[model samples]
Target chain A: MMESDINWNSIYEILTGPALWFTFIFFVGGLLIRLAFLFRLSRKKDRVIYNHFSLAWGLRSIFQWMIPWASASMRQQPVFSIVAFIFHLSLLAVPLFLSAHIVLWEEAFGVRLWSMPDGLSDGLTLIFIAAALFLIARRRIRPEVRILTSAWDYALLGITMLPFITGFLAYHQWGPYEVLLILHILFSQILLILIPTTKLGHMVLFFLTRAFIGFEMGGRRGARSW
Target chain B: MTSPTKKKFEFENNTDAPVDVDRVRAILNANDGARIRTWLSICSRCGLCAESCFVYVANDRDPRLSPAYKFSHTLGEMYRRKGKVDRAFLEKCYQIAWLQCTMCKRCSMYCPFGIDVATMIAVARSVCHSQGITPKQLAFFSDHCDKTGNHMGIPVEELVDTCEWMVEEVEDDYEGVTIPIDQPDAKYMYTVNPREPVYYPQDISYAAIIFAAAKESWTMPTFGWDCTNLPMFAGNRTLAGKQVKNVYDKAQELKAQHILITECGHAYRSMAFEGPYMAGYPDGKPPVKIKHYVQLLHEYLRDGRIQIDSDKKIKEPITYQDPCNVSRNGGLWEQARKIIPYIAEDFRDMAPNREHNHCCGGGGGIMPMGPDYKPYRMASGKLKADQIKATGAKFVITPCHNCFDQINDLSEEYDLGVKALSFKEIIVEAMIVPDHLKLECEK
Candidate 1:
């Protein structure tokens, strides 16, 4: 590893520097906007569903499920779900456990973490890109799904594949890798901003919904608190 | 796409025709008014409801039976073509209407958006009502409720006579129990589901015994004492309203304290929630405070009026199946929960209990919807059966009559070996009638 031996041409770096600004501006600003709206909901349904038996245990279970430590929902449909599950698992693992991403976290956020080998990271990243594209194609190709799908669904799926596609290309310094890399970071940042806003809100909202059902149904029925 | 064969199920009344379309739509519009517009607009079609529906679970993941598909035939078409769809499309809607569902709201519990598929199907039924393609069974029952003041065609004489009979039975257990029907100044004119009078007369007996044991001030009206509504279940709102007004007028005539709907899902729903809406009364938060049987009984149990025998408890493990109309439709869970454990000793739970519990596979008039979906009914029952099997419970304590019917049919056909009993049956089995108990409230 020879430091400062290789360099991007001045103009290319200049082009990418503007992209960095785009990433940072949207990433920070969009996150704030997401949080502001989410917190602003006037109705306090949280109290209704908040299990009082053990608040800490409930929160721990919720956090574990959201992080999805050993979740079994995907087991409901094993064959179809495994590939997607593996892809999701690896996508999460690679983002949290990649040497490059890990190093970046330490640089920017002052966090330290272990990372996987280069081959493992590369393989997982490839799986994520391939699996995402497969899902999109399957969605378009399936008639029943196509009938129910909306414009936002297609756009969302396409946006999801962007970070993976650009990230894969950005690796190995292939065609347009540097440019694609900036786009990858851009899309990833956009996804972070979207997590609580879009249907991706399913991540935060499902537990709330489940807990609501459990609590209301239980209380109304005079069962012990959930 | 095609009309269902009427030969599958024998319908009792055929003279009356289905309502005309404009009138049907007008009735639905009057009831829902415009809420249908927003609810239909927000469907994201996540398909979690498919997992929840009995038909879908029973049919091995067939996309056609999914509630989303069923709705697409009617509400879906209305939305997609901006209501400009052809008669062929409307005809397809009718087939999905009569064949696919019984209007049970089990799917709504799983819906992330809380879209009431049962209500939408009722809209389709109202559309069918307009087309004059109403099912013979529903039209008959609705008409029966209209003309006879009860869906079973129980005449005023027979209704009073049944109550008189109940009064006599209660005299055996309690000292001065008097079960009066149509008496002029009674505080309550209790209305029972037609099921109790027609197929399960003993259910009425249990209610009477319990009512007497509590020494409560309640009476049954000779008219409006039958609470079952075919039109509500069949999805005809005009007929549903007419069906409801029969009870409302009779209850009003008696100037009763509260009309306690019998242990039937649709009856309680129609009376407690939809009845007020259609009869020019308030919505679910009604002024009249029409109580469910569970509410009445639970209150009686709570106040030390009606008590069950803890020693008389069924030795077998018993679990409850919550009917959506009772638990979710009206949000009356406390009453049932408080009362259920008192009736049985070995209380167990079926997985996904309460509002999340699966449908009885016979609500929304699926029992009368026809025999065309009987296989689907049994198949869907497997999910519930599996849930019960997990609990290792021998009996399922379902409060609603149709739940008893559907679960009984499935248990018999599928060898579930699980007895389906009404809360009354279990309660009566364990009831300890006080020797000095009197019918008249001391108040």
Candidate 2:
């Protein structure tokens, strides 16, 4: 009924409709292309990996790294290891199983999946925010970390944290709730689009690398990469 | 600082060498395999690799010494610039690749993605090597390998002469001990680091004593006697390949069942694991079975081929320096550990020993890089010094010549008051000489 309300509604509609679809396609398709390219390149240039490939070693390498304190390096830097594991866990869980996110996915796909309890999701979101800030502070405070940190690293971190921050604020009605929701969707889409184009590609590339190294070190050399 | 009175081996930078952009691009393109491309693409620079790097920890935790920073700034920058990097940039790459990191792969275990930073450093070295931008000492050794089939440029005649020399010394203790040269159909065709023949002929005598005591059917190859491939450390892969092939072909020619490498770390890694791959064997296997000295030592003790005299076992506290190539890359850590307890009464394992052990900072051909690098080398070796000091062991035994030399220097510099030794040195002391092999004086 109000003019500003109508303006926000139209903007929200576009972001959720065609814009959201475009972001989803770009994210999934770009990642698939990257995976395909790396696979083809590996086949051509590094046949040694395929020759020595072992599913057992590869899976073991991945799982060992997945568990906290399973690696000596992880054990050496206890704080960083704990924070990193928690940060990654929250990054994956909150995005997929948060009730609001599930509702959106179900609405768009006409499909439904289990959603985590709202309280738990909220707690994870807060943890994600805190972990992200801690990581940024570490990058700033630690000399070894500080020298490697670039403006781009800080920018990427900001991009990753914005959606959660805005969502939290919007959920508790801290500011213009509709504006915050729209900004949240926008930031989430931006983050998705950037995944395949930036260092965030590690989300998937990590597994392939772990597997390759696992084969080279474990299967061939009888040495564990992890 | 190196004393001016001490002759410098010179870092051997060809400052006058022309930096051909085409050559740079070609080298980068050739090395830009899936591993490099993907690894360069995905490093988020989380800097967890800092603590994993001994150099970083040793150099007052300098971030520039971080393994991630080292490779990322060197090869990653080269790839980012599409190999259009200038001579100045390539010089920096040379410093980072050769001087900063040891290519030990300790950081590889720490990387969340399991990124092989050592591989990247190798590639970076290759790139620098293309432009005549390598440490002079390593380059000279690589050239020696190319010219004489050994790192020290020792001719086949000299290798035979040294074996004879070692035989004369060993024969006084073990009557029948002989350093057999180029014998055909031997069970194991043994090889030595060129350093043994040049600086430490006693090591050859020790090997002869062990073989005599064990009655091991081993023969040394006259032409391919040198197992260590400094070319690999020099980043000259072609030369490295040829060096490995010499030993591999010699073993094949002799009809030897196995090629037994000496108590050297890089020699085992280059000759066993990396050499076949460099020589175009994708499966990473040479035709003949390759065995490290550690593996053979373990086998001899386990099968009772050579018995360790209980009374002669080392009584003082001792520790084993796990060479990166021998333990981490070669996976003979358990074998080395098993050998230690058999030969020593008290064995104190270094904290973060085995696959996770820090490099002694003399690898990647740094020891061969000579006196100019001694200052930085000793500085980087501080972590290893501290590790040795913590064990409070009087004897620091290593299966690697590079590690032995570096640990010796660390002891001298850090005042650790430890005697650096090799596996052969300990075994020769503890091994019981057989009745038949014992000299008449002892009998």
Candidate 3:
């Protein structure tokens, strides 16, 4: 279909209406089900004596791991840690601080937070793209990482990077603005939908994994997980 | 590189035949739980866990031995197939789970997602146990523990006789020192690994001497004296539970306030942590408090209950090997570190001591897997051997029996030239027995 002939309003409605709500429902409902399933599994009833500083130690470990220099993994893989830190930081910052995203929040919830400048947003988007590419390259170049790299692992990376790439293109108006904008929204929706079921679930589940490990190892076992 | 001893445990000769595929599926299904499901789901296959594994590192970073690969090939495959895997595949899972990995849980520390790889391997082991595919030696020991209340099958008469012999042996060192047997309502019910009586009876003497010096009210029970639970290693949870129950019942019968475990890692972990759960006790709490010997020694040192002669320290440089169960899994690392300085003239720390220390490769029942797996176990301990060698210490003091045995093997195999001694041995050596307390030999 010709770009001009495309019904932009209808497309925006579909993307923001059914697609957005469907992905949100699936993402939330699927995560809840998975969590409930996990809880239903047989748990051995054991009263473990936790250390007095377990909570503090667990929180310390979580924060320590979030910093590249503070983690043991950083000593072994400094390059990966640096790139991953940037990628994770930008992953949260770029999307949350985008002017368009803030506007959407203002429209939907009547609350608006600070938004990043266009130039800063553009710079972060580029860094995010570069970080994703570096991760994919590392997986390919490193023999150890390469062997564990399944097709789905690559697919998850591609899916994660799509929204940023499309947003960049749409923001720069490199291609037809209407088409790129729709593509960005579509990719974002797809990502939201797939997250709960795929490795992307790590975004949400990482907290539980870290907290559980911290409590079990640091608190109960008196050992540091980090 | 199979040793001649390992040939005796030939898979073809095993009497407990492999179960059908359906049975394997059922076992896997039974083990399904939140922990397994979450771990299986969240691991991003980032390969960060690879560096933390000794086997993977010792094997020249072989992808096949990586913790991720081990999980994928065994538990991951089981999850994928929903337990409908064929016999050949099940057998492969048995080797990967039992022989390849030691279930040390070190990798979990490095994992950003904190996947409990060791527990998943335990689940895989449980599956193998259901199929009767465990190592023959492990099964034999578990059966021995079931029948004779010890891993080595030493009868009650021999156990009592051995305690009496140890008491007489220690009498030469200190006067008025006695090894009480079956003393009820004591403050501590002291238990030990069967290996003490079978192989190293002197270790028992050392513990007795330390207890006597501390003037602690401890007694050894004749019934459930074997604190080491082999079934916990063999993946027989039911039998593991029974063993824990036996010990609990014995302690309750003796009316001891505390169950004092010797310098054994797995025994302490299984009893103090896994025991209550295995015994089906409410909230998985044991009937009484459980304390490792290291904790007791630490308390004694802190409270001036036992006096260590700081001037009589060993001149040779000594290092400490953190036992996986006691240090990492049990959280008893600092206690041993605190006690080492008082006993040794010069103490060295391993590069990655404490929770991050590498496994001795003899854990998860690998030590009891016998001669057939000895070469494999020794080879996998290359990292541990290198860690010890780097310390350049004359002696390595480990508070756990398994680490001591494994470090001893690593020292011999790698020619590290380090003697592996228990914490009690070092403590006894540095302890000052007053002239008034020392017994003069009768001419």
User: Which candidate should be chosen as best, given lDDT against the real structure?
Assistant: 2
B1-443: candidate 2 lDDT, tens digit per residue: 12223442344575765678788798888877788888888888889888999888888887788888898799889888888888778877877888788899988888888899998899889888888888888888888888999989998777788888888776556788887778999999999888889899898888888888888898988888788988898888888889999999999999999999999999898887888988777776787899998988999999999888999998999999999999888888999999888999999999888888889999988888887788878988988999999999999989999999899898999999999888888888888777988768888
Better of 2 and 3 by lDDT: 2
Q: TM-scores for all candidates? A: 0.70, 0.96, 0.94
Tens-digit lDDT string for candidate 3 (B248-320): 9999999999999999999998998788877887665789899999999999988888788878888899899
Give the per-residue Cα lDDT of candidate 3 at B17: 49
The order by descending lDDT is 2, 3, 1
Over the stretch B1-443, how does candidate 1's per-residue lDDT look in tens digits? 12224443333322344334455445444444222443454454545456667767666666666777788668656555544544455556665775567676666554544455776787776665555556666777767766776777877676667667766765655566667666655556677887666666667777777666676678877766777778776555666777778777776777777878877887877776667555655322334557777777787778777677789878888888888678766567667778877777778877676655667667667676556656656766677777777777788877788888888887887778888877766666677767666334531
Q: Candidate 3 regions off by >4 Å?
A: A1-8, A36-58, B1-18, B440-443
Winner by TM-score? 2
Taking the tens digit of each residue's C-alpha lDDT, what string does model 3 give over A164-197? 9999999889998888899999998888888888
In terms of docking quality, how is candidate 1 classified? incorrect
Give a tens-digit lDDT track for model 1, residues A6-104.
454553464346655566676566545644543443122222233222444334334433432233333333443556567667767887888878887
